[model samples]
Target: MSPQHRLTDLPATARAVIEDRTGPLTSVDMLSAGLNSPIAARLLLDDGTSIFVKGMRTDHRWVWTQQREADINRHTQGLAPRVLWHLTGQGWDLLGFEHIDGVHANYTPGSPHLPLVLQTMSSLAATTAPSSIDLKTMPQRMSAYVDDPRALTAFDGSTLLHTDWKPDNVLITGNRARLVDWGWASRGAAWIDPALWVIWLIASGHTPHQAETQVRAHPAWNTALVPSIDAFTRAQARMWESIARTDTPGQWTHHMHQAALTWAKHRQ
Candidate 1:
């Protein structure tokens, strides 16, 4: 991924648009480029308020994710940071969000943050997807990865799903966990989210069985069919394998690829 652009590096028009809403920035501090966004920064306004902003060139391949995050924010209410403003001009698209004062969730075994994360997931699973806009379905997203199309049915559902559960996308506050980066949100079986989390838990030091045991605390997991979970594990393993092969092969991707494989094997 390309390095994030400093706030000063924004085009004049883009800066003016942002400053108009923010009342001029007192300082611009760049934030970590979590997962997919090219530009992630925290803007401190002259009024002494701060907001987290993420942006990218208007024509960038992942530009749609910015729009998705903004569109999906309304449904995420208590689960994520609210979108403060959106700007599209001068060849850039940016979104300013209510800055969350929190730290990335720890998924390691026995971490206190795990229960908080699960609580948020259960809240999210109860949400209905916005029918006004088209959202991708998990089955469609994984179809290319699985050999038997029939297995994809296990993933289909109407529930709103934050498909990517990477720890960076989850922030642990004092008593709750707030999800971030909704670009990969999708419509899928409620249990699918817990299944996705399992791979990350394994990567975070939980044995596959231990990870599954943890997610069983989720109501959705109790309703999931064993074969369906098996199908998802298999598809996930193949999907990550493809990602590892095609996406510059980062260490994290390779690690996740292995994690998925381990989960898949444990299910067999």
Candidate 2:
């Protein structure tokens, strides 16, 4: 991954935009976590308030993600960081968010945080995707992975799906797990989000069956059709396989591919 940009590195116009909303920026602490974004930092204002900021060059390939994240945060209720403002200037697109005091969730087996993560997923599943946001459906996303495209229909739904379930994306805070990074947010089957988390569980050392049992607490997973589940598992395996074949496969991507394969084998 590329090195993230520091607030001081931003152009005068961008810094001015941030200061315009948040009284004079007094200090900046850059956060090095999060894989997709180029900027993640906490800005302390002169008024003693702190806010999180994430941004990227307007012409970057993933530039759209900044706007997508801003849009999804508006509808995420309390599941994600609240967007305070979005700005575009001096070649960068930025979003200011309410700072969250929390740590990334641990998804390993026997971790107490699992239940909270599941509960958060359940609440997120119940939310209807905002009608105004143009979201990509799961079926459309997984179409290229499945041999029988018709199987993709099983993933069709209006539920908002935070398709990325990496531990770093989930924050455990005060008896609940707060989700962040809405770049991959999609509209899909309510159960699909939990299903995505299952892969991460396996990657984090849970047996495939054990991971499935953990997610069963969600009503959507409990009542999901066997065929739909099978189809999704297979599709996920293929998706990870494709990702692992990238020019340079990261350790996590390779592990996820192995985990997806493990889950698909268990389904068989």
Candidate 3:
């Protein structure tokens, strides 16, 4: 019921398209505090059905990113949001899907979510490129990650990476766990995603030491090099800072360019 529950930066065209699809929207609200794209105040349709919507830019990388995510979400069976639309006509670039009632995995995790969270990492990682020999989407690979600590180490690029795999990206409903927001995902080393999530947890409130323990305890990143994990966490902190200062989407370009150098170092 507060201002945080309403969408603010949406263009007029996006709002209209959403209205055209869902009928007259009511109780327009927004979810606040995230760094990437804005996702809030899900639209409710005529039958009392609701769908989450996120208005984004037309960056080809982002276009590729969201398209891949939509595929992965549906492919994961139930661990993600369904992609109902990506409105490009109205500067909306909307993504509509079923509304979820779970909260973000922001704090130290407990049972189901924790176990499944690790499992999801393993699952996504299982699909990474067979070899790190030639990595595509290099921009998302490591260029923007220059500020990340993991930039100092080599990323195998063989495992499927949920590049934005943080606690906030994981949603839990009852004992069930569903991974969401695969926008920055790719095929990379084992610890990349888990390491990213751990740093976010630590920087947000969780202690770095404890976060390292938690990440190491996970079967996915646990098998990875401890030093690489550390560097990854360091770089992730820097990336998060960049995200916080993201006044416009254009900065994402600089972020990737810087990260490329870091990721390239890991050619080994």
lDDT of each: 0.87, 0.86, 0.57
lDDT of 2 by residue, 86-197 (tens): 9987787899989889999999889999999999999998998877998899999999988798898889998999998888899998998999989888998899999999
- The TM-scores of all predictions, comma-separated, are 0.94, 0.94, 0.68
Ranking of models by TM-score: 1, 2, 3
Per-residue CA lDDT of candidate 1, range 1-268, in tens? 2223444444566677788777878887766647576667788889899898888889888899899999999999999999988898778798999998899999999899999999999999999889975899999999988878998998999999998898989999899999998988999899999999999999999999899989989989989888889888999999888878755656688889999999999999
Query: Candidate 2: misplaced stretches above 4 Å?
Result: 1-13, 247-250
What is the per-residue lDDT of model 3 for residues 1-268, given as tens digits with 9 covering 90 to 100? Answer: 0111334755567678887776776656666644456444566676788787765656523455556555556455555767776555554456777788887764553433556666666666666443422234433545665655345446655565666654567887766667776666566666676766654444444454555566676566657665665455445545545644544545433443233324333322
Q: What is the C-alpha RMSD, rounded to one decimal, of candidate 1?
A: 2.0
| lDDT measured at residue 81 in model 2 versus the true structure, 0 to 100 | 82
Steric clashes per prediction:
0, 0, 29
Index of the highest-lDDT prediction: 1
TM-score of 1: 0.94
Q: After superposition, how far is residue 201 of candidate 2 from its true place, in Å?
A: 0.2
* Native-to-model Cα distance after best TM-score fit, residue 106 in candidate 2, in Å: 0.2
